[model samples]
Structures are given as C-alpha cells and as structure tokens.
Target: MKKIIYTMILAAGVFSTTACVDELDQTPHTEITSGDVYTSAANYKSVLAKVYASYVIAGQEKGGGNKDIATTSGYDYMRCYFNMQECGTDEMASTWLEGDKVKDISYLTWDASDPWVSDTYYLIYQTIDYANEFLRNATDDNISKFSDSDRALIKQYRAEARFLRALSYYHAMDLYRNIPFVTEKDEVGSFTPPRYTSSQIFDYIESELKDIDGDLLDRSEAEYGRATKGAAWTLLAKMYLNAEIYTGKARYSDCITYCNKVIGDGYSLEGDYSKLFNADNQKRTNEIIFPLSVDATHTVSWGATTYIVCGEVDGNSSENPLTYGVKSAWSMFRLRGELTSLFASGDKRAMFYTKGQSQYLDTGIDTQTNGYLMTKYRNLLDNDSVASNTASYGASIDFPMFRLADVYLMYAESVVRGGDGGSIGTALGYINKLRERAYGSTDGDVKTTDLTKNFILDERARELYMEGTRRTDLIRYGKFTTSDYLWQWKGGVKDGKAVNSKYNYYPIPQTELTANPNLHNDNY
Candidate 1:
C-alpha cells in the first residue's frame, strides 16, 4: 500500500471549489479535466489513491515546490494539526516563529488572519473535497460497468471515502466549533456554503459513519491504511465520547456500545510502545487501526511523521539524526517542563534525552537547550537500529492516527463518565494492559478505586503525548482556557495564565468572513 501511492499516476485535475475564493485555493493537478480522469474505471482507483495520498504528500514530487494546498513552510496536514493539538498544552512547547501561525499556535494566540490556521482550514476542506470528488465519480452506474468482484470492491471504496470525509469534518469541528459543511451532495461550484452549527456537523458525521457501516470491510480483511469497520467504529466511539462537548448531549452509553464493538473485535496493545512510533509501524497492524502511511522512498512530505521525528530532535545533537533514522534535526519543539513529572518511577515510556538539555524551559522556547528533548519516535526499522537511505530522504516512520491504545483509553474514560454496559473491572483490565506494556510489569497497575477522570486524563497525556490528542483532551476536561489548569507559556505568558473564554472557540478566519457573506462571528 505504501509503494502503490507512488506507483499510481496522480490525477491531473481534481474537483474545483465554488466556495468564496478566499476560503478555497484548490489548484488543479494538470490541464486534464476531472471528466477525462474519471472516465475509466481504472482511474477510479487512482482518484481514490489521491484521496488517501493527500494525507501524506504535499504535491507531485517528493517534498517538491509544486504543491497542493500551499500555506506555511512545513504545513503538512497532520503537522499543523499537531501544532493546534499539542503546542499550547502541557505536553509540547515550540520555538518556531518563522511560519505563519507557528508562534500563535504554541502560545494560543491564533486569530482569523493567522496563516497557518487558515492553511490548515483550507487543507481540511481540500481533503473533504477530494473525497467528495471520488464519491461523485464512483456511482452505482459506474460500479455497474465493472465486473461483479470489482463492483463489490467499488462499493467498499465509496464507504472508505465517506469515512475519510467524516474524519476531516471531525477535525474541523474539533478545532473550529462552527464551520461550513459540505458533502458530495453539494456540487463543486458554490456561492456560499450554509454555516453549520457544531451539532449539525456532529449529526452529519454520526449519520455518515452509520450509513456506511455495511459497505465497510472488516478490520481483519482490509488492507493497511484503508478505512475498515474498526476504523469507523473507533471514530464513532470517539465522537460519542465527546458528545457532551460537541452537542450538549451525553452519549456515553453510545460510546460504550461502539467501544464494545471494537473491543469485541481483534485489536489489542502492541507488546512494545516504542515500536508503535518507529519506521516499521506496518508490522504493528494488529494494534494500529489507521495511519498516515509514510516511507523515505515516497510520500516525503515534511508535514506528517517526518516533522514528528525531526521536530523532536535537538539541533545541538545534530550528529544524532541518523541515530533517530532521519538526516536532519529540527529541535524546534520539545516536551513541556510540566511533562517531566508525568513519568513517575520506572516508566519505560519515558524516552527523554536530557544530557545537554534542561528539564525545564528556564529561558523559554527560544533557546534550543531550554527544554528537554525526546527519543519517543525513531524513523528506523524496529529491529534494525541502523537504517540506510532514510538519512538522505525524510523519515520512514508512519504516524498512528488511531490505534487500540486510544480505544482502550476511550473505553475507560467513558466508563468513568457514567457510561453504561462497561464494567469498571473491564476498564481496569484494559488500562492495565497499557501499563504492563509501558512498565514491562504489573507493578504500575492501579486498582479499580484508583480509576478516576483525573487519572484517565493524566494517563492519556503520559501515553498519547505528541500523537495529537492533548489540546482536545484539555478542552474536554474543562482545563484548556480556564484557570483550572496552567502550563508554561500558555496564552503567550510565561507563568501560564487563564485566557479569555473566547479561546474555547477559535475565531473564524477574517478572510472567510469577508469573502462569504453568509458567514458571521456570532458563533465565535
């Protein structure tokens, strides 16, 4: 699947957007028209390939200048998502101020004009538009033209496309509460997309997942990196877990219902947590439900796992890039001083490289040596410490977007939040599985009485740091903009003060408002 992404010829032209020009800048792949590209059934698969490939590659060439969604310098889809999700929380700190919204994201000072935020907005919409184009082309009449086996397969492909679009909408709803929502039903040329309330977006996402259930392949049967029953179940479970926040309705019971589906199926914890982030992540397919598949030979975007691997490296140890299986050391982002205490005694998950770095960001994010560095992610093969070719290209490491570990955490959290049909004992057993893997023993296990919402939150920080869940977790727990929780440099202040409640909902990009008359700031 990783090599197939490069083997297929990228579609020359994709569906163009009709939304206000300021909100969308979707450049065509070539002079070729969407009609010419989707005429043949073989091209149907290729267009679908474009949908999945959009997550890993920025443009035609590997990290080349001919780009798709241009915004910031290193504006990879997940890379900017990481900035929005982690940098302002206690889990991560960034020193990068060069890009559009690098500083704003790290300090929680982002506004409508912030370039990176705007780019990220366009990128998410671009992804949805790609999926929409695929769905529109791969229709029932189109499927009828194919062989029986091909017809069955094409149906599955449509389900995967819907799931991907729903995933993007979930991200949009998470980052920016109220947003413009569109689907394949909405044609390419648009005057103004009706602004969707947070609940409207949530209902659309939930129904989309449920509608595609029969068409999705079973998790065990689906190929790696493609959406399957487990992926859909996991995503639905996640939205349900956050139902109160998204829709003002408690859906913990539904969260548990779907979580049981994933649990009853086959996913489990990988024996080693380190292998989950390493280059040979494909081997951990039993645990990782969906990933943005990447390798050094192809999909060389600096925005995904490459940024994750290189960004963690301290430039002072420039000689150690190969040690982490990449050629360059960004050393731009690091663990917050507050995170140092999360790793208690004997937690093997602690992979800090503090020899020449400070445990705390004493002088703040500017100085490279101000904060401790991490060895959590390595771009080399799991078995081989020394990998070749990775030094010249970017990282070969794949980022696990959703995995069994997250499912386990979600189940435990739902149970704690008054979700029914899941026993506290079962939740304990699931969490202990992660603890045993992290500590290599049962010594770190906790009793049923020890399982609380606070424990679940900290456990998530300890386990899911840098995987892009921190900011959302903080918001869900009522600690993001309130005085309830404070970390270093939050709200652009070194001491970490409570920001305005408006930070809860990031302002709509001013560009979006000016271009689309239907858009308003009343929600923000």
Candidate 2:
C-alpha cells in the first residue's frame, strides 16, 4: 500500500481553477494545456492524487495560500459537510458566533444563500469535475505510450476516478436532490448541464457503481485512503438503504445484498472503539473501509478531523492539554442533551465532558459551558500518545468515511426494514457485537426481541455519534423535521421544535443557480 503524498503536479493549479468555472462560455484562467500535464503516466498519477487532494487540501499551495474556493473561510470538503451533517442534527451544537451561518445550520434556519451551502455545493462539483477531467485525459489511448505496469496502474486510476465521481454525485443527490449532472464526456465551457431528478441521479450512481465494480481494487488490496471494492459496496448499500428517500422506492433487499458483499470482504471491528477515531487510525486499516487521510505534517489543513478535534474540546476541562494532542482548543462544538441521553452510564462510547458544561442548552446562547463537550475524536493515539505535531491549525487524525461497524448497523436496519435474503438472527448478532465492544463485555448485549426498528435507530446514534451520519439517520427515521425527535436549539428555539418537512433535502445553492441558468433551487 502506497502512502498518498500530496505532490504538486505541473498543471494542478490550472486544473483546480478550471474545473470550478460556472459559466459555460468562460475560458479557464490558466496558462497550461491538458497535453502538457497528461504527457506521461507519472503526471497522470499526480493529477489523480490532486483529485483526492481536492477533498482534504483547501488550496493549491498548502496552508492558507491560493484557495480552491475563496468564498468561505476554512472552506474544505469535509469541514463543510460536517457543518451541514453533524451541527444541524442532535449529535452536535456550536457556540462559535463568527456568523458563518453555522447558527443557521444548528437552528435549522438555513437557506440557499448560506455560505457553507454554497461552499459544499461548489466543493462537490469541483471534486466531480476534477474526477471528470482525470478520466477524460487518462484514457487508454492517451496513455498508450506508457509501460505495461504504468498502464495497468492508470487503468485502476481511471476506475478510481469514476468511483470518486459517483461518490460526489451521491453526495449531491443526498444533499441537493436536484442538481446539474455532468460527466467526462461533457465538454467544459461548451454547454450548461441540465438538472437531473433525484431518481435519475440515483440510477446513474447505481449504474456507475456496478459498472466499475470489477475494475476497482479488491477491498483487501487498496492502499489507505484510496477507494476499493468495499468502499463502493458501502456507498451502494447506503444508496439502497436510503433509496426510498431519494427515489420513492424501497430497495432494502438490494441494500442487504451489498452490505453482505462488504461484510464478506473480511473487514472486522477494531477491538477498542476509541482507537478507531484517534490520530493513528490510519494504521488500523482492518476496520476502516475508506478514510479521508489527514496528517498534521504533510496533509495539513483546517478541515478534516481538525474540525472534530479542536471544535469539540472544552475550554475548561480538567484533562491535560496533551490529552487532546492539539495546541489549543477552539471550544466551538458540544453535544446536545438528546445525544447524551442515548448512552448508558456504563457505556464507554459516551465520551463527553460534563464537569462544567450542562447537558441542557438554555436560551440557545453561544457560551462555552452551555452544552456537554465531546471527546470522541481526539488527536491522541490509543496508547495516549500525542500526534506528531501539536499545531492548532492542523491535526494528524484521519476521518473514517466508511467502516465495518456502520456496515453491521446497516445490515441490522435493513433486516428490520423487511429486507429479504437476510436473517433477523444475523442482524441481532451484528448489533450485539457492537454492544460487546461498547460495554467492554457481553453483559450489555441485547437479544432478538430487542432488535426493533426504533431500537436500531437509537443504537445507531449510540454507536456512530459525531461521525457525520446523524442527519441522514434522523431523516430516514422520519424524525428530522418532526417533533417526535427534537434537540436543543432546533428550529432556532431553545426548547426545540418541529421544522418544515421541505428541509429534509437542502436547497441547491443560490450562487450556483445564479451562475448556471440550468440549475434551480428546491422549493423549501
């Protein structure tokens, strides 16, 4: 497995800027051409690395210079996604009052003009376009001059590029239900891509995933942070799991099939749940199917797990500063009351600081002690060692985008959802496996009778908190916009209230719609 080093490719700067153009007729502001960049197989590998780098690194030059998207501060793919996914749900709350529409997200008052919304939308397309450009230039005929081994590598790279495009489109379909669909064949700056319905996008993603299934690296063979067969299976299972939400059709049986494929690929849960999130998570590749690899030294950025580590630290906690492995705490994010209640007192997964912080959020004020601070995603290793660098600006922790534990949960949920070809007994066993780890013993394990639809939802919250899956889980359970499940500061009220159902899917960013005439906003 090769370490994914963020090397500066020759025309990467031009590639980054050109893929972000919104206008159909505007020429890209670049001096280099595709021929100069894609002349050799090594160059193609470098560009492929750039396509992966687009998600973690915010700018062309490292550390706060020449940003990929300049409209928002701390604008990166995972950071923006975390703000939209975790902050708005019951899992997290923030007291950072810099007025970046984070409060809007926490309170469920976001609109099309929100900066994070625009940032996320632009970042998704930028990633998709980058993948598109790679697939376009890295074709077999174009790379015919390369050696046999390099050509084989380029073939895998092309498949990975397609997988990445499908992943971004999946995000678009999940977040913005209706979006302009583009691909490698779509000529840049020639015509505006038309919008596709959510169902159409769903079919496209399903087909793309299946088409590349044979071409991708085996689940056990891919390098760390690279997409593999398990990653595609996880994404496909997720799509099928939420098929009803996206396409108004139930595909639980299909979801179970893919989940089983990933489960059979030999991924096991990490013996210690806490170690699965720490700085050295990259070393624990047995469980993590795919990770957004972050390092404090090489892949330094303000986004990724840096947001999780710094933002969740408490200002006045009794723990040593080195316990967090970061220079200073941002003291921004905290867990809401509803999230803390899901864990039992003995459950080790309740990794929250409650000394000075209150469980209840009163008045919805932006104070340090308003809510319990979370320590789930620390910068320390499992052995309590600090990461290599302690800089406040960068964190060494890697964010696990998909792991085997979630696959187990998905299997259980699919069984509870009346999915065929899977047994309730196996689903119960999977749920208990997680419980045994969470409790450090089999004492907390539940039987088949306890495995209900509602129990699976609560168990997901307990097992997968602050992992950027809460909002989607809430929406699938029909509690995101209803009063049945409310957290502090929901609907901009301290007591928490129901919001409009239209918020289930975020509106397409207003900036995108204004720049491209083919796109339109969802009527929320």
Candidate 3:
C-alpha cells in the first residue's frame, strides 16, 4: 500500500517528446519537463499546484476585467446584431454563426486558420497533460502509507485531477465535436486517437465521475470550495441534463439521479443571492460546491476585480479612485431585454442588472436600444480595494464552477425528464427553494407547475452570466448558431455583413497540423 505522506517518482527517467513546432524558438514554459523534481511530497504538491495553474490563467483571460468574450464589443464581429450593424474584427469571424439568422459579420472572412480557437485548445489540453501526469505517477502504494483520513485526501486529489481532465474534455467537446481523447501522458504518436463523438465524450466523463463517487468522502468530510462528491455529482448531473442535446437521447433520469445525490448530500442555498458573488463571502457559505479559490495574499487572484468597468451609482461599482473611476471600453456582454423583463416584480435577480432609463455611459438607458448591464461581478462600495483604485476596482468574486442551486435546478430538470420522483413537483420544489434564497425571503408557500426546458434555460441564463458556460448552454439548446448579438461570429462579415458558424470548432494549430499530418483540421 502507498504511504500517504510519501511521494513516488515514476521510474522512467527523462521522458521527453520532440517538438514539431518552431524548434529554433525558445520552448514554451509549459513544455518544461520534470528535472528530478518528483522526488518529494512537496514536489508532488507543486505538480498538483501546476495542474490548477491553468484555471487561474484562463480565469484571468476570460472572466477577468478584459471581458473579452463576454460583451457586445466581443460579439461585434458576428452578423447577428440587427441593431449594432457592423463586424468589429476578423478574429471574431466564427461568432457570426451564433444564432444563424444571417451570415457574415465583418467585410473580412477567414477560415479555420484563426489562432484564437487553436490557442484555447492547446491551453486546455496542456492542463489535461498536467492532470494525466499526476494520475500516472500517483501510486496506490505511496498513497496507502497515510492513515485512513489522509488516504481520503489522496483519493480526493486523484479524483480532482480526473475531474479537471474531464472538464477540459467537456470544453473541447463543446467547441469541437471531434477531438483526440488523451487520458494518459504519452508522446504524440503515429497512432492518432480518432476524435470521439460528442455523445461518447459525455459518456466518458459521466463514467469517470461515477467510478470515483464511492471513493470520494461524504459531503460532511468535504471541505468548502474544494472538489467533493457534490461537485462531481453536479457536473455529472449537468452532463446528463444535456445528454439529449449531445447524443440525441435524453438521460433526464440519470440527470435526476445525480442531482438527487447532490441534494441529498446536504447542500443548501446560501441565504443571500449577493453573498454568492461577493469576495467577502468566499468559502464562508455552503451554497457553492466547487469554486475556483482565490486568496487575497496567497494566490494573486485578481480575477474580474480589476476589469469590469462601471460607475459607482450602478450598485456594482466601488468608489475607489484608482480602479474606481477608470473606464473600460469593453463592457462586452449585456443581458437581453427579453430575459431581464421576464422576472417577477419582486424577483431578487432583477437587481443583477440596471433597468430602464438608468443612464449608461452618457446616454439615457433606452429599453428599445440599450441592454441590461450585468452586475454579477461588479465591485462593491466597501470592497477591500475601495481606497486603492487598482486594488478595489472589481468584485473579488469566486467563480462558482458547481453549486447547490445548480444541483437543485438540474434535479428539477431531471424530474421533468422522467426520474422516479414527481417530475414537475420535484422541479418546482427546487426552483422555489432557489427563488426563496434569491429574494432573501423565507421558504413559505412557493409554488409552480411548469418545468419547461426553455424556462430552465432562461433561469440558467439569468443566474450564470459571463461565467464561461454561456457558449456550451447556448449550443446545447440550438441557440448558439443563431443569436443576433451586437458582436457576431469572430468579428468577420460576409457580403458586407457578419457571418456565423464559419468556425464552430477551433482549427488544429498550424504547428500541430504540420507536426502530425495524420491529424485533420476542423473546418476552420
């Protein structure tokens, strides 16, 4: 049995892969190999740390202040925006296909040769490699040395690695229906693993999560903000919820099963909706399952805290001078007016957006023209960075990867899909629970009989804006290829208009394409 406190290095010394990319240029920092560093437990910890490094990096790029892909400016390249009539850049050429109403965003059009898609693929796969290394080297013998309590920790770590890998694959499958499924660390070979169908990929993820569910500690043993049984079940529940879209077969029953597991596992909604997004509430509440943990001192996690640009009166902005007064041109995403108006008069989510007639920028808020500015991650009035402009710019919100609310919603959806429980009744019970928490009201006499998929989709949209699941959810519901946002399809326009769906999947990188002739490119 493996000793829990000890570390073991794989006996294979100095395994390295030859690069097919520009060999003369300095190698990427990610390509660096283990140079006798795997000899101790601390080294193993570092490796584990490295596995999570990508979350911070990607989080910085996507969810950070840049708001690069979340805003109207980001969608300027797509042709879907009827009101905002122009493509912004060639880089966003693929976004035009988001809702499929029309084709072409920018006057310029390009194929899969775009670098953005390929770059993300590389980043995600690199993360998977880090996780694979841990899986390959973390031996049961080395892990058994610890007391049972510590052994659970090791198992948790292993499960965490697998979860990350599965997450990376889920991302890949979302963007590109076909991708090489790499489960282990091996040299890129002549034996190319053909792309698995999207259905197959989801199956793979569900199976992996299920296999480790028993090994995972019960919910009480799980620490807050870490991957736990709740997190795994939530992810599996979501995968099952979307099974019909991915595989053309509904797995609502399975979805409900996982959702029930998460609900029965003892997670409840945090009392305040605002608590879920504020930095001060991090790890203090049990509402969240798996969160990307960022510490003020330890991790250097700026997140969107410095990036989202809004004035102090908007309720989401801080009064700080440094980051407070600064204006960011890229308020890239805004909520659809249709979605914002769907809330009940007393709905708590209404506060998430600035409503009609509120001046945005310099213009009066025009309901017919202006959209609702999402305040989910905005800086608060009394933020840590309130005095310091640079420090107090945006809200230090922990990105919720999985949460109890989501589990409840997924369970409800599963009931609608025919789980053993009262389909509409089960779903309504959870939705009402979420509503109570969202409005900060006591759970009393809540009721609903409808459980439409479209309604659930809208609820998810309201709850999860700019949190990175937008694209996947949109695609699964058949809305991605057709949404007419201001910035459409990778900023490319066709026939003097923006084009959409030109590049659904990221193209295989030029470097990879050249290296492995066996690998084929997605229609770039």
The residue ranges of model 1 lying beyond 4 angstroms of the native Cα positions read: 1-7, 27-29, 70-74, 98-101, 385-391, 522-524
Q: By lDDT, highest first, what's the ranking?
A: 2, 1, 3
- The alpha-carbon lDDT assigned to residue 116 of candidate 2 equals 76
In candidate 2, what residue range of length 10 has the lowest lDDT sum? 17-26
Tell me the deviation in Å of residue 367 in model 3: 14
* Candidate 3 lDDT, 1-524, residue by residue in tens: 10111122222221222224332112233433554555445556555654654454332232233322231122111112111111222111111134422232222243344334444456556566667767765667766655676665566778877887787777676555666676654554233455567788988987888888776656677554446777788888778777776688888787877777777877777776765665554643477777765433323323323333332223332222233333332333344434455566666766544445232212211122244555555333334343123343333444566777777767765675566644676678778777776666753325564567777776775565444455556556555444443222233321123235633334555666666555666455
Residue 418 lDDT in model 3? 66
Greater lDDT among 1 and 2 belongs to 2
Instruction: Report every candidate's CA lDDT.
Output: 0.80, 0.81, 0.51
How well does candidate 2 match the true structure in TM-score terms? 0.95
Two-way TM-score contest, 2 vs 3, winner: 2
Q: What lDDT does candidate 2 reach at residue 33?
A: 76
Worst 10 residues of 3 by lDDT: 76-85
**Residue-pair clashes per candidate, as listed?**
1, 0, 63
lDDT of 1 by residue, 181-284 (tens): 77777766754688998899999999999999999989777777788888999999999988888899999989999989988888778898899988888889
What's each prediction's TM-score? 0.95, 0.95, 0.72
Off by over 4 Å in 3: 1-35, 58-111, 141-153, 188-193, 301-332, 352-369, 378-395, 419-422, 440-448, 482-511, 521-524
